[model samples]
Target: MEVAYRIHLTAILSVTCFLLKQGLPFRGNDESSNSLNKGNFLELLDWYSLRNEEVWKTVNQNAPGNNQLTSPKIQKELANACAMEITRVIVDDIGDNYFSLMVDEARDASIKQQMRVVL
Candidate 1:
């Protein structure tokens, strides 16, 4: 992959991980379509741009006309890949080892059922 593409992908993965750690949705209602939304990946990119102009510059350099990689569909696909890679690493670390896991189920304030697994 091109360096700019790699950098962009890395930035996307980093932001996705941050969102996952915070238990926040990567895409909001306003971002359901192709348009950019403030609280989602677009905001993350803007944050990066502000935090470090050089890094954002590198990503923008290789980005075609626009940053198509920042689209919601692309972001979701990249997030899934990131999750899979993380799970694979965790599973590999547990290979040939016995580990105890606890699953807790509860309803959140919105009355949605949620399950958390602790290992």
Candidate 2:
């Protein structure tokens, strides 16, 4: 899998598991079966998260600030790829000359995805 995608999936799984811990609805599973979805660097995230819920909270809640200080190059690369895909589909259907690519992004713990539209 792509590096950023791997990171993204890790975030998703972490959120899912976090929600599960906080009594969020999930598909269903047993801890004994060991079928949990820990996407990436599970050991490290688990260790850090266990050590500091406050830090995790800061990271989660203060994302805007963090992102401002963090390089979003990889994230933007993925977003750009998605946008190009959307643009390709629209241009195929309605030709490229008159269309514009518009992008919007949304995020929660469980999912962080970008939406693209042709206008």
Candidate maximizing lDDT: 1
Q: What is the TM-score (0 to 1) of candidate 1?
A: 0.73
Judge candidate 1 at residue 66 and give its lDDT: 69
Clashing pairs for model 2 are none
TM accuracy, model 2: 0.26
List runs of model 1 lying over 4 Å from the truth: 32-37, 58-62, 108-114
Candidate 1 structure quality by residue, lDDT tens digits, 1-119:
47767677677778878887787877666754355675666677668867876657765554675665777787788778878998899999999899999999999999999999999
Weakest lDDT window of 10 consecutive positions for candidate 1: 31-40
List runs of model 2 lying over 4 Å from the truth.
Answer: 1-71, 95-118
Error of 1 at 7 (Å): 2.4
**Candidate 2 per-residue lDDT over residues 8-119, each given as its tens digit:** 3455445444544454333333322254753323333445545665545444444454342122353345445555776688779886466556777676677866455447
**Residue 71, model 2, lDDT:** 29
Highest TM-score: give the candidate number: 1
